[model samples]
Target: MQAFLQQLPALIGVVIGALASFAATSAAERSRWRRTQSVRWDERRLTAYAEYASAVKKVISLSVRIAAHRGIHPDIDALPPEEGLPALAAAEEERTVKWETVLLLGTGSTVVAARAWHESAFRLQRIASGREVELSWSEAIDAVSKARRRFYEAAKADIGIALGDVPESYDWQISRLIAADSTPPERNT
Candidate 1:
């Protein structure tokens, strides 16, 4: 009896240590789970953003070509006017799909930016296709350019990426588009 009584404190200490270890392990596991979820969600958001932006840009490109080909912007005709209608329609359909995905997966601010970008691009498309009001090529370009910049800024904020860290290719593309509108397109000889 005396021996058992003497050993009771040691047994209690062992039990407490085991329980402490178990608690720490459980906490660590929960924290790891949360981090994994965060990383997964971040990846999804990035994919959505990229897909949406790419699709919208495709539509914008088609609109510009169609407009030029149709003499809305006669100086920049890169394609025959007849060829542009089908291509623009296809691009618009693709943009609709991508925009739905953005609506599903995007954060609030990101969704707003995406919508703004789409609307701006759509306005230009309507003008180019003669579906609605007419605008000069430069006017349409300026509106879309602003909208694109706004979307990129919002996306950067949402993704926690510094503006300077954005890919050089993206910067160059936007810069080129804006520059393209700065002066009239040169007539090909």
Candidate 2:
């Protein structure tokens, strides 16, 4: 009994030291894992966000030009039955691929907002291209405008790394729109 009691202190000390070492190593490993994933996700999300934004903005510009054209010509004149319709169709198809990638890579809120924006944009583009029918042109335009704003809000709020150092010259009009439309509640959330 005396010898066992004498050895108990050493065994206890060794067990405690082993546990401490394991805890320290585990904590360090966890921190390293988190940092690695943080950088990876940040890079991925930024790339996808930028691509999606570029695609959507291109569509929006075309839509705006079409609407302005309709305004310039008579209501009966309609958009020139030109290649613009075909071009818009191709862009929308490509946009679907981009949106799919964005959804796969983006976070939850970003994914949801992106889907909403893309759906609305898709409907608007279809109408503008005359590939589909729309009851009211104004409604389509308004939907596109809202979707664009929502997309910007979702992208701006993401903590993507490249988002921090994004060049100002890339999309001046887009930045202006985001700034003007994305409220604090919309972004900070």
Candidate 3:
């Protein structure tokens, strides 16, 4: 009985030390897992922002072509919004395959603005080719033009933030990130 009593304190200490080690290991593993997940989400969000921006820019380029047809955009007449919308929608879906990525890493405002702008573009496209034209061809074209410009500007800014990249349209963001003697942030990252 005396021997057992004397060993009790050492046993308790061993048990406590083992428990503490297990807890520390568990915590470290959990932290590593979370960091990995965050990195993946960040990559996905950057892709979405870039891809969505690309899709929107394509639409905008189409708008420029259409405007040129109407003497609005400079020397551009390669637009067919009716055919463009489907492809753009497909692109958007593909780009946003992982929703949580966008929700967690990308800015919600950019998504919201992009959705609204797409809806507006779709409406204009319906006017261009649908059961009936709710708006005149000129009005529809004008609407598309405005939406495209807005989309381009917003995308440029947001994509810059998301991927540490600059939008093609935003000269300032590009300049800001350009290293006088170093590579750009996106390239470096």
Candidate 4:
């Protein structure tokens, strides 16, 4: 009986050690779970941002093509405005659906940037639709460029990406439009 009593302290120490070990393991698991969740949300946000950007670009590209066809852009090779109308309608429809997803998944700043970009795109669309306001290629392209820069900045900030990651010459699409509009299209046999 005396020996058992003497061993009670050892038993209590063992129990306390087991409890501490369990607590430590539980805390580690919780931390790991939180980290996983954070990574998942980050991936989701990136996908959402990228998809929204792509969709917006599609609409802008179609608008550019339509404008070029209407002789609003300097491109001589573009298909006529009538030929691009169906594709433009399709792109607009896709943009509407993708914008809904952006609204659901985007942060506040992202949404704001997206709205600005979309508005800028709509300006080009209005010009393509023959608003008769004499919108110039430079003016339309400039607005889209500014809005796109804002969106890229907002998206990068949201994802913890440094602003420096964006290249200085970022408007590849707009540049392509300008260059295409300036040059005459090759004749097809």
Candidate 5:
């Protein structure tokens, strides 16, 4: 009886040690699971952001082409209204479909930014279609560009990226202009 009583403290210490180890392991596993889930969701949100941006850009591009037809962009080759309108409609439809995914996966700020971008893009479309003449092409383009920058900023922040500010780049437009100017005119034989 004395021997058993003396050994009781040792047995109790073993049980406590085992319980502590179990608790620590459980907590670590739970933390790991939570981290993995967070990463997976972040990846999904990033993909949604990218796809939505691509869709919106397609709509904007078509609108720009249509606007060029109306002599809004002197540097760009004009796409006739008959050809531009149908393609614009198709691009807008794709943007709408991509918007649903953004709504589902994006954070609040990101979703708001996405909405702003699309709304601006819609305004650009209206300008191209001659539905809204109050806003000039350059004004519409600036609005869309600003909204796009905001959306990208929100998306980057949501995904834990630390990009300070997205710089405004109109290099593509400048390059296009330069290329157009450099092209040699074809001579009639």
Candidate 6:
């Protein structure tokens, strides 16, 4: 009985050590799981952001081509409305579908920026469709560019990318001016 009593402290110490080890392991595993989930969510958000941007850009590209056909963007190659309108519609549909994913995965500010970007793109579409006459093509393009920059900024921040300001490109204006000096190709409707 004396021997057992003497060994009780050692047994108690062993049990306590095992419990501490288990607790530490459990905490580490939980942290790892959380980190994994965070990474997975980040990846999904990035994909959503990229897909939404691609879809929007596709719509904008189609609109620009159609606008070129209407003599609005001389720098771009004209795509007659017959050919361009259908393509633009398809691109818009794609954008709409991708937008759902963005809504599901994007952060609040990112989603707002995305919405602004797409709305600017819709303005371009309206101009190309001859539904908006008040806004100049150049102004619409500028608005889209600015909105796109904002969306990219929001997305980068959401994804923890701390890069500085996104550089603005004036290449479009330069190209437009250069093209304006020359005659545009005749667009057959």
Best by lDDT: 6
Estimate the TM-score for candidate 6. 0.85
Q: What lDDT is reached at residue 72 by model 3?
A: 31
Single out the weakest 10-residue window by summed lDDT for candidate 6: 170-179
TM-score-best of 2 and 3: 2
Sort order, TM-score high to low: 5, 6, 4, 1, 2, 3
lDDT by residue (tens digit), candidate 1, 66-151: 66665555434466546767887888898899888878877788888888888888887887776765656666677777778778
Of 2 and 6, the candidate ranking higher by TM-score:
6
lDDT of 6: 0.84
Error of 2 at 7 (Å): 6.3
Least lDDT summed over 10 consecutive residues: which range in candidate 2?
Answer: 180-189
> What's model 3's TM-score?
0.53
Mark the regions of model 4 whose C-alpha exceeds 4 Å error after superposition: 1-5, 132-137, 165-167, 172-189
Task: Write candidate 5's Cα lDDT for 8-68 as tens digits.
Answer: 9999999999999999999999999999999999999999999999999988888877766
Which of candidates 3 and 5 reaches a greater lDDT?
Answer: 5
Instruction: Estimate TM-scores for all models.
Output: 0.79, 0.65, 0.53, 0.80, 0.86, 0.85
Clashes of each: 0, 0, 0, 1, 0, 0
Mind giving the per-residue lDDT tens digits that candidate 3 earns over 70-171?
Answer: 333233234454554565456445444533344455566766666666666555444433326566444554454555455555544654443344334444
Model 5, position 59: C-alpha lDDT score: 89
User: All models: lDDT?
Assistant: 0.76, 0.65, 0.52, 0.80, 0.81, 0.84
How would you order the candidates by lDDT, starting with the best? 6, 5, 4, 1, 2, 3
**Over the stretch 18-63, how does candidate 6's per-residue lDDT look in tens digits?**
9999999999999999999989999999999999999998998888
* lDDT string, candidate 4, 33-119, tens digits: 999998888899898888888988888877776776666675554656677778777888888888887788788998999999998
Q: Which scores better on lDDT, 3 or 4?
A: 4
Pairs of colliding residues, candidate 4? 75-181
